[model samples]
Target: MTEIWNILFNPLPNAIMTLLTGMSLVYWLFTMLLGDGFEMGTDADIQFEGADVQDVDMDADTQADLETEQHVEPSFFSKAMDFIYVGKAPMMVLVTLFKFISWIVTIASSLVLNLAAFGWKSVLILIPVFILSFFLLHYVAIPFVKLYKNVGYAGEEAHEFIGRLGKMRSTIQGEQLGAIEVVINLDVIRLNVKSKDGSLLSYGDDVIVTNQDPNKKFYIVQKDINLNNI
Candidate 1:
């Protein structure tokens, strides 16, 4: 085990993989130990029937994933992520699998080539390892995506967001566009938004949707007080 850890941390590519996978392990450990008290991916809780927004714990990395969800630019990059079932399962989970697979491939290839740690042969080893990781990631994630859907997670249409209460994913002021997180049907969704009155809305500030732009440019929002807090 000591020799294994040494090799994993020595090579450049393997080192990166080890770091990412190590973080994933820590995240999963926290998720397991804390149970329902700690939800790594629950962005914002919403009560649609009574119309209320509630505070939920979320880490920075998961929040970043939600912020960019369904909003990635450049069709190719977006399509590539979709190809690997990114939206179906948690992005971080897929990322963890990708890195671990890459690390395994790199280490195995290095052994086959008799490449020394931090050696030139290990440098060449990265070429095929990087490519193989993607294919493996694509196949390995299939079961996870199905399992995620088994939990009844489904995204709703944008029109359903009107009159919904949510929290700001980023600061929005005046005409500048930003993101707001809302929950519907047990799925967290982020939509482009702008403060209705040109006021500054910072992250985690409660907001309610007033209306949506005619052309679907963005949602018009304003500060909202959570009734549950009163």
Candidate 2:
């Protein structure tokens, strides 16, 4: 047992093993802690800024084409392809692949170093590290990939709604107990809004979809011009 302990704890080999193990641990920890909350994926409508909403026609044929497309199940190989092809933010798959490669390299190198430095007895140290790596990869790394994907989808979805034109389905009055219903993406969303001038607006008032507050997750709207009057 003393001889086995010496082989496992030998200062020279343990130094390299510890460094690699610590690096792997830190990488997993950072992804788990921060990657989940951060957004990833492309905003489909990012380029439509400052353009008149009326000028941009929502093509029915294009919408129909998009709707008719079949959802294909991405094979493991295809997912890997996406990681390479689609280089978007919050790199979930790519980071995971890198971590996987790191683990492989770390374990292989550790094994070689251990064998050279301490022979077969070093297998004892390798066993525990291998087990630790497996648990960390499965529990920590996998969940982070899922979390980053979710955040990415949400960010992209929210971006789509920005600058969309909607009608005032209900009156938006700033008076006590006054609220407005706006049709956004054909969905009537109720909003508790105040006029920019702090005046009460009437029912069927034309309101423009303005800004969305991230912290409050609500829309900041403003009055729109009456086309009939214009």
Candidate 3:
């Protein structure tokens, strides 16, 4: 137990990775508990600013097609991120996975390196360890991404939840926040939600989805009148 504790928090390198790993684990647990709709990263509508413009004159169709291609083309950073299948999985999910794996590798490598080399600081070992871990994560996350891709909203399914009936799993104070469970294509999905009105909705309360804020990835919900009458 003492050794495990030391590996997780005592050493400087282990401490930093431990915090990252713990946060990542917590995010995953929260995502599972609340529903796959809780997002802690950027939304799909990310726009790349200041892209190079083409000055060639073309027909409307050709121009439109070129614009579409440009929009679809991943930026350099996004292309690099593809090594870890960024778009194939939720950002938080990917981050959590990478951090957890990095933490484990950091601990093991630190122990081994300490034996071979004396008087080396944990910080010095961190740079190389992190770079190696990132390379390993790039490959390791592929299969996991493929596995989870079908389970969550990888594409068009992201917007399918709109207009669906949702049941509150947690209380939502008006203008505050809450969580709700809804069924889509026979899959029970949980999503972060906010009341459409400034009213309190308690757990087990049935609500109706009125809209979705893509920027925040939260649903705007309202009390179901029919269910309230029951």
Candidate 4:
């Protein structure tokens, strides 16, 4: 067992790879546990609803897949991330997967290349290892995320959610915050909502999505006046 441990991660090079791989795994575990509470993919260019506007060409084939989500420009780092997946799942999940795969490859190569004995010479092996693993995963993630999106998990896009009916999950009184649950394409999703008119709404009151925040993070909603009349 000790021998095997050393083979996977012991020497300085292996130690670095193991650390990278471990960080990725730990992060994903936290994401799974924390769910939406944790912002795992801060670097991811895409969101659950759609791609950041400027980073995406908008004409790309993947854009057709999202059909209903909002569009916005992502940060520069996120634009680089666009080369990978376009956000079928949370960007955090994709980022973690990419790191996990790359780190594993880096570790494996370090062992096989026997860079442990080379001292400073290992840098030669490490540089190319990082580049190859990074790009390799970037290209591979596109198809994988696309496939994940296709088999269900459709229609939770921002564009489609706008104008959809949702029930307030909490009370909101004038410029305060609330949550709304709406069904889009038969899928129940939730969003942070605010009233357009600063009107008060009670829990379970019906509301309509009137607009989205500039950051596209949440919805601006209004109480459905006709709901009470009906």
Name the candidate that leads on lDDT: 1
Q: Which lDDT tens digits does candidate 1 get at residues 110-227?
A: 6676666446446767777878888889998898777654442224222267788987767656666666667664455556677898997777788999887775546789999667
Model 2 bad stretches (over 4 Å): 1-162, 169-179
| lDDT (CA) per prediction | 0.64, 0.43, 0.60, 0.59
Tens digits of per-residue lDDT, candidate 4, 1-230, equal 99878766655666776777788778668756867433323334345453233211223443443333323333555345445643334455566666667667767776677777887667566678667766787766776656544432322343356777887656676766556666644434546667788877767788988887887545788877793647
RMSD (CA, angstroms), candidate 4: 13.2
Clashing pairs in model 3, backbone N/Cα/C closer than 3 A: none
Which 10-residue window of candidate 2 scores lowest in summed lDDT? 49-58
lDDT, candidate 2, 98-130, per-residue tens:
455444544555556654566556546555655
The TM-score leader among the candidates is 1
Candidate 2, residue 85: lDDT: 25
Better of 2 and 4 by TM-score: 4
Number of clashes found in candidate 2 = 0
For residues 1-230, could you state the per-residue lDDT of candidate 3 as single tens digits?
A: 99778667756777888988888777668767977654422243431111001100123664464344333343465346556665455556667777877788878877876622433366566778777877888888877665554343332144355677877656657565565666544434456677887688876788988876655446688988894557
Per-residue lDDT value at 120 in model 4: 63
Q: How far off is residue 131 in model 4, in Å?
A: 1.0
Better of 1 and 4 by TM-score: 1
Q: Where does candidate 3 stray beyond 4 Å?
A: 35-76, 115-120, 155-157, 160-230
TM-score of each: 0.51, 0.26, 0.48, 0.46
